[model samples]
Target: MFCYQCEQTAKGEGCKTMGVCGKKPEVAALQDLLIYALQGLALVAVEGRKAGVTDEEANLFTCEAVFSTLTNVDFDPERFVALIKRTVALRDSLAQKVKAAGGKTDFSEAAFTFQPAADLNGLVKQGEEVDLKNASDDNADIQSLKHILLFGIKGVAAYADHAKILGQEDDQVYAFIQESLVNLLRKDMGLQDWVGLVLKCGETNLRAMELLDAGNTGTYGHPVPTEVPLGAKAGKAILVSGHDLKDLEMLLKQTEGKGINIYTHGEMLPAHGYPELKKYSHFYGHYGTAWQNQQKEFAEFPGAILMTTNCIQKPQQSYQGNIFTTGLVGWPAVAHVDDKGCPSLLDKVKSAVGLGCSSQGKDFSAVIKKAQELPGFAADTDKGKVMVGFARNTVMGVADKVIQAVKDKNIRHFFLVAGCDGAKPGRNYYTEFVEKVPSDCVVLTLACGKFRFFDQNLGDIGGIPRLLDVGQCNDAYSAIQIAVALSQAFECGVNDLPLSMVLSWYEQKAVAILLTLLHLGIKDIRLGPSLPAFVTPNVLNVLVENFDIKPISTPDEDLKTILG
Candidate 1:
């Protein structure tokens, strides 16, 4: 098994035996094979589109299927097998439809004509046969670019899937996914072509994030400044993790007034800022820091836990039964709540794919039931409160004030400290960097990376808070919009503005966001805790030469360089 798609892959290279994320070799093989199956499906879907046949089901499934292959999302071999079969079934079915529509279907490419074995062992063998780690003959630079495109597509799929769940989608995004998948298989594409494709993936991710922002704001109302308690109220509780807002809202609806208080964990901490979600009286404060710290946090929580999307860890035996995964997240033998039944927010994900979206979602009654059975927060404990709800709308509402502060030099600079967080030691750089930001500067933060310093008392600049919580990684569009607006107000490019983006990346979604930044001609961005293993030195050199991207140095050094 060769996997190096995340920041924490083994020894700064591929994981040959197992994933550092606790993914087993078998599951890794299945995930690779799932991508292979999607290639076949995408190959046909591209042809189908040419024939004037656009299937919403096929489009949504492609997103879901591609999303499932992302790191730390699904770790169950059984789940991958089911997804692989589903993909192949959809592929063949689409091929027939294309044929009926007078599109050519006969192709000898292995991806087109390949058949899956009936058993798990046989499927793993098929996966090994198609594993590109050993099978590809492309130059290292081309392979690196393809990896970038593929990983970026996964991020696009994830954001697109979330948007669709909330009734927002664009067919153009689906078309890009199929076209990119087909292009990745092209042997004739050179480094320059692949580079353009990678940038295009970034542009596509921008749209996906835009759709997600629309879905989130349109349904939930633009986030208004709200203060969430860090304390735990005495009652049965459920800690919702991952980045899906609809999942948390559905659970909030189902668990309403059942003597329960809902809490957010990791990226879900930003949910408190959204007007529609925080309206529920039962919805309470945030519980944990970031995704990497889940095992400890989940263990201490007395009530049930629900993981909505990605950023899940192996379940500890103590909290395994209390933890449940819904939507695309999975772990072996851990109880999973499928997108079915009522009092659920996710069955709608399935219905949204084919059947029209309805109010019904994934059943959370079981999760609520588990909460009732456990001891929740033995007593009321006030851990203090933290401010959220500083997304684009809220920040822009005070944009005139912001512009004035910058003009008056009351705010000397703007720093965007955002992106995914990880368990590695170097991650502490983010915490220290935010702590050291001058009083005259403001830090715009988002995603789980903010957890490193979210609770810090950074004080305020004039009437403006020094720290702004922009929302999740899925809300990159909001962050981008903020930069764009600031750029426009200042009549200068984003890079020319006094704002610097210092980002921490851990997964494919981060890759997509980075590509989006590069695509926009944003330069001199500081990126760390570590660089991606998939990027070869030549590819890295190209990135550095073109984008002025730098691996992070000490926070003090970076701050001096940027502020000077």
Candidate 2:
């Protein structure tokens, strides 16, 4: 498979045998083919757009296809095979339309004209030919930049898909996805060209995230500072994981008054801040920590589990039958709910919960029965509360207070310790980093990474919580907004403010967010647990020279460096 597109790639390098995320060789091969097909479609779409011909459906498909290839998003080889075939059909149709419009079409381009093998072996062969390592470029540095851009696109596609579901669409972001993919195939492009495109990918991702933020806040109302229950309630329940608010909303609506309580999990933990979702009395507190702990946590939970998007690890046999996947997530033999039919998901959940366990050992009632006996959010209050909902509006609403605190020396610095959480060893750096921060500094966090010390009471400074949960990773846009607002209030640039970003990345979404931070000229950011395997030393040099990017040291050392 030779995939090194995630933080936990095997041995800190490419996964040649299988993905650490439970993706088999066949699945990895198919995902590669799917990406190649999407690139081909992008080539045709980019050309067609030159002639003022475009298809929103094609754009949306490209985004969703890339998103599905992200780590733990889909492990179903059959699903990738189907998507590859559909991509070819779409690409060919677009090519024909371009030609009909009197626009030049590249009939010779491999991405545009290559056909997949009818069998799995053929598909693997096709994938092997298009692997990033085998690209025409012989320079590892250039190839690394290309892969960075490709990974960034995957993140952009994910946020774009989320936005599209809420009826929010941005043509410029879609157009950039097609343009960048076509550019990636250009052998004539130089390092500077690739570097420029990588930054542009970050710029486009910012737009994608902004669009998603709009969609989410527009649909569910802006997140408010509400105290979320960190415990579960006493009743039959279902845990909703992943980052899809729409799916959570639908599930909550369908399960209302049906005796099945809904609890947020993983990135969905932030859903409690949304007034529209919390309005449902049945929508209780969050359960578990992050995506990496699901295997153990899911087994211990006494309710059915529904994963709505990426970050799904392979289901353990213990709760395998009790889990359901919807949206773009997939695992072989796992029941999936198609978004086209909302009722399908509800029906599947109902059926799975009602079936109970028979002699076949498929029963989830025991899990649920045990879950109710466990103390959840009700027991968490003794630890005190951490404040969230400090998104752009929330922060800006208290801009004067923050500014005054800074002037009064009550708040000394701001640290954005955010990004994904993984099961890997060095992740505790985040917990220690947040723990060691001086009380005078405010910690801004987002995504599942916040789970590390979210329950820790960091206390508040002048009425502002020391640790601020800035929504999910998709809400990085909000973090940026808060930064920009603070900069304006201070009458200085973001870098000039007493701010530092110590981020941990595990997947493509982190890559995109990092790129966006770079695109905004934010410098001296610290990234860990380790640098991406795809980032060659030469590329790293470029980042260090231009952006002052640094790999993380110990929390004490890094804190001294940043505080100094």
lDDT of 2 by residue, 1-564 (tens): 689999999899889887888989888878888888888899888878889888766887788788889888999877777778778877877788998998878656688777889977889788877776666378788889989998999999899988887878899999988888887877788999899999999999999998999999999999888787666666677898999898788777666666667888889888888889979998877778899999999988777788888989889898887788877889888877554323332253333221111122122333344335443233222323345676778778888999999999899899999999998899999999999999899999999988899989888998888988888999999999989988988889999998999999999999999999999999999999989999999999999999999999999999998888
TM-scores of all models?
A: 0.97, 0.92
Give the winner by lDDT: 1
Error of 2 at 309 (Å): 0.9
Error of 2 at 209 (Å): 0.7
| Model 2 poorest ten-residue lDDT run | 353-362
* Worst ten in a row by lDDT for model 1: 343-352
RMSD of each: 2.5, 5.8
In candidate 1, the residue pairs with backbone N, CA or C atoms under 3 Å apart (3 or more residues apart, or in different chains) clash, namely: 344-361, 344-362, 345-361, 345-362, 346-361, 346-362, 347-361, 347-362
Q: What's the number of clashes in each of the models?
A: 8, 6
